[model samples]
Target: MHVPDGFIDAPISAATGVVAAGAIAVSLRGARRELDERTAPLAGLVAAFIFAVQMLNFPVAAGTSGHLLGGALAAILVGPYTGVLCVSVVLLMQGILFADGGLTALGVNITDMAITTTVVAYAVFRGLVKILPRTRRSITAASFTAALLSVPAAALVFTLLYALGGTTDVSLGKVATAMIGVHVLIGIGEAAITALTVGAVIAVRPDLVYGARGLEQRLKLRVNGELVDAQAPLEPATPRTSRRKLWIGGLVASLLLAGFVSFYASSNPDGLEKVAADQGIDQKAKEHASADSPLADYGVRDVDDARLSGGLAGVIGVGVTVVAGSGVFWAVRKRRSTSQAA
Candidate 1:
């Protein structure tokens, strides 16, 4: 969730800021091992796609809505460390450019949404994958389960943060129950999206999916009574679809979702926003620092048509996120290559 300003006091927020910064620094180093030439660009695209999908809020309850939290999806597609960077990039873009999250509390949003979700979900995913089969179906199943749990876990984290530095005097027990309750419903949506997206990619190009890599090599055939490796091809099997084509298709899907489908997204408050207003969490909420930006509130300034304004904003967001994320990943990749070369 995008934590706005005043939900948490300055000291805790600053503490979270340091935590976020340290996590990013470590992630940048770990990402080098994860991102080579083949997967580096795709990692950036995955980040942008998450940004696009997050704009499409689906109805969850009578008044509450939810969108893809994207931790499981990213972790399944890309490595967990890179997954953290992806969501972090989206949060950074939203905070600075779209005013979706507050600048002062950007660290809170990153810690709660990006770092917490990715770390917890990926841990769950790895544990499940070990016990379950290594088939793509099992991967998809693990993704769903991981995503389902991650949202509530994040809510619990927020409850703890609020208990520590809440700006209001709301009941901590009530806050925990309510936040976890609504977020559980949101978790179902998160699970479905994560499973479907991870399933689709694994179906098309399991090689491109970071979490599925080892599983591909483990595919075996039962011969007589023993498990044996599948016969290796003398030559590499020709890919049915080119990486360029897949990239193009993914980009198109992202554009369609954000540009057109987003217009139909439920206008109700999302799980966090709804819970905040209901639980008195927003009693001390402050205005976003970038509220007056031209692209604030997911709309272009002075655009009369709501649809066009939002559409343009969505497109611009996708473009900027892709560029920024790619730049970061490619630089990391280059550094890795240089170090190896030297």
Candidate 2:
């Protein structure tokens, strides 16, 4: 849920801005441990994919809709720190380029959507993995549970933030209940998508899936009445395909999700917007600074056909987000390389 401008007072907003900035700085350092030769490029794709899928708002309740918050998916595919950066990058792109969220409330959105979800989901996922069986099914189940809980956690955090500096005089209890209720429904969709995506990646390349790493335990096989440990799948196969193809495939999927599939997304207010209106939280919401931009609101300027305009905008968004996110990751990777060289 993107926090629009004037939702929280200036002081609290500035505080959250500082918190978000610090978290990003720390995550950058942590991501170095996560990003290497193979996963570095995937990090960028993670951001692009998140941006693309978020455009396709699925129906949640009767009139409300929900989109991919993407923290759990990114954390499961890449790493938690990198996941935070991925979602943060998407939020930044949406705010600056598409005018989807407000610039003033950028920190709030990042804090609520990126930081909260990643932390909570990753913690839950890792804990479940430790307790459950070391199989792909377990990983997928954990991913689903983590994603499910993460949405409500984010909603609760957002409610707390709003209570601290809410612009309107709304009942805190009502806001909390509505936010949690709607987001729970949204969470179900989030879990399914996250589980499916993680399962897909794990099926093809378990090594590339960050959460699946180190889970390559040998299976026992009975040979001549003796228990023998069989070879795990982590080893590179003889006909091992280059990771470049997978990266390219991911990029193509991202493009299709944003450029084409998004056309069919539900055209209704998301859970946050619906609750904000219902609870009067959006009473003081201000217009986004980029509202007058040519490509504002996910539509290309001067494009007559609704489909074409949105498609073009989505394509452009994916391109920009991938480029920007790749630049950040590549720079981080380079810094690591230089340090190791020294």
Candidate 3:
């Protein structure tokens, strides 16, 4: 939810910082098992796409809007550990480059948004897939249910954090009720987005969807009166749409969404911002440290044309996020290869 500075006290914020760091450390190791040559690049693109979709905030209530949180979408498309890294990269870029989320509260945002959402979404997804049919439809259904629950789970986590280190003396019960109540509406949007995106990827390249993998049964044949797995062709036929083409298409979609479509996003405050303002959570909120950055507030400095400035900022954000995310994933993949060789 992009918690801003001064919303949580120094001690609690620092504690969350430690928690975030530890989780990242563990995820880095875990990602090695998840990322290989085929999926590593796709993982980076997933991060960039999440960054783009997050810009298009949809109206949720009278004054509140919501955006794709990306945890369930990423976990379903990639894997849980890499999903955490994907969201973390977006948060890092937004904090340092866009001045959107608070630098001081980075840990709080990661813990609530990145860690909690990914863990909960992936867990729910796994549970549903285990019980449901192992079809693409079932995977999509699980993604929808997982995403729907993840948003409120994140809201509940934020409520707990605020209860412990809230700067204001607001009623805890009221805050929880408002936060959970509104986020449930937001969760519906999240569910739709996650399901549609996952279903699209599964349709095109089910091989690339981590959650859909292992669902395809090998063709069985009767040979010499015995049922046996069909022998794979020595030279596997090329996929109609190559991974390179998929990556290019995804990047183009991200560019379109962020560069132009975001202009139509509801201008109302998001769920977090609306709740904070209504609950007096922002009474002690401090200004973002990067507020003066050229790209602050998702606009280029001195770029008078609102459309052009925002478009440039969005494009730059997508470009930077892709490069950074790819770099991280590539390095992780390299480490995996080196260790295997050893």
Candidate 4:
């Protein structure tokens, strides 16, 4: 959920800001081990992909719709630390450029959507993979289960946050019930998308999928009573410029998704927003600060055609998000390179 301003009190929001800042700082350091030459560029792509897919909201209930949260998908594709950064990047871009989420509540959104979802989903994924058969199917299954649980976990976290710092005197129990119930339906959609996307990537390039890296044994075949791993023929180390091609390809895909495909997304309020409105949790919500921005509400300013305005805004959002995300990841990669050299 976007969590607009005035939903949470100032003191609690400030406290969450500090907690989010610290968590991001820790994730940056941890991500150094996760983002190497191959994964660093992919991390940025994961962010942009998340940004793109989130634009396509699917109907969940009568009035509620759901979209990809991207924590599990990103974690399965990249790594947990990098996944946090990915969702954070999308949230930041939506806040600053699209005015989808509130600036003042940025920390709240990041904590609930980025940090909580990634942490819970990754933990569940690791646990399930440990017990299940080490097959690609098992990995897909684990991804599905982890993604399914992550959405409700995030809803619970928001419930707790609202209990502590809610601006209105709504019943905490009722809020929790409604939030969890609606988000569970949303979680199903999240699970399907995460599994399908992870499955597609694993099919094409399992080497690029962080969660499937050590699980390659599942793809091995038995030869003369001995197991032989079916690893892709190792490529001689190539120039770093090759990675730029991948980055460019990912950015182009994100642009296509947002620029054209997003026009077909359902025009209904998402799960959280619908639930809040139905249950009166949104009664205390305030307007977004950047509501007056040209690209506010995912439309270009003075554009009469709804399709053209939304399409242009979506394309600009993808462009801005990819640039911002790639810059952060490239800096992290460079720092890692420098440290290794030293």
Q: What is the lDDT of candidate 2?
A: 0.92
Q: So what's the TM-score on candidate 1?
A: 0.95
TM-score for candidate 2, please give it. Answer: 0.96
User: Which pairs of residues have clashing backbones in candidate 2?
Assistant: none
Model 2, position 336, has a per-residue lDDT of: 85
Task: Write the number of the candidate with greater lDDT, choosing between 2 and 4.
Answer: 2
Candidates 1 and 2 compared by lDDT, better number: 2
lDDT by residue (tens digit), candidate 1, 156-217: 98899899889999999988998899999999999999999988877777778887766643
Best by TM-score: 2
- Candidate 4 segments exceeding 4 Å error: 218-249
Question: CA shift at 198, candidate 2, in angstroms?
Answer: 0.8
Tens digits of per-residue lDDT, candidate 3, 16-68, equal 99999999999999999999899999999999999999999999999889998
Cα misplacement distance, residue 166 of candidate 3 (Å): 0.8
lDDT of 4 by residue, 1-342 (tens): 888888888988998899889988988988898889888878888898899989989988887788989899988888999899999999999998888877888999999999999999999999998999777888899999999999999999999999999888888888999899989999999999999988866665666788886763435788999998765432223333455665677678788888899999988999778767876777888888888999999999999999899889988888788788889999998999999999
Q: After superposition on all CA atoms, what RMSD does each candidate show versus the true structure?
A: 2.3, 1.8, 2.7, 3.2
Clashing pairs in 1: none
Determine which window of 10 residues in candidate 1 has minimal summed lDDT.
231-240
User: Can you write out model 2's per-residue Cα lDDT over 1-342, one digit (the tens) per residue?
Assistant: 888898898988988999999999999998988999889999999999999999989999988999989999999889999999999999999999999878989999999999999999999999999999778999999999999999999999999999898999999999999999999999999999999999887777778899988876568999999999886764345424457887899899999989999999999999999999888899999999999888899999999999999999999999999999999999988988988899
- lDDT head-to-head 3 vs 4, winner: 3
Q: Alpha-carbon error at 52 in model 4, in Å? A: 0.7
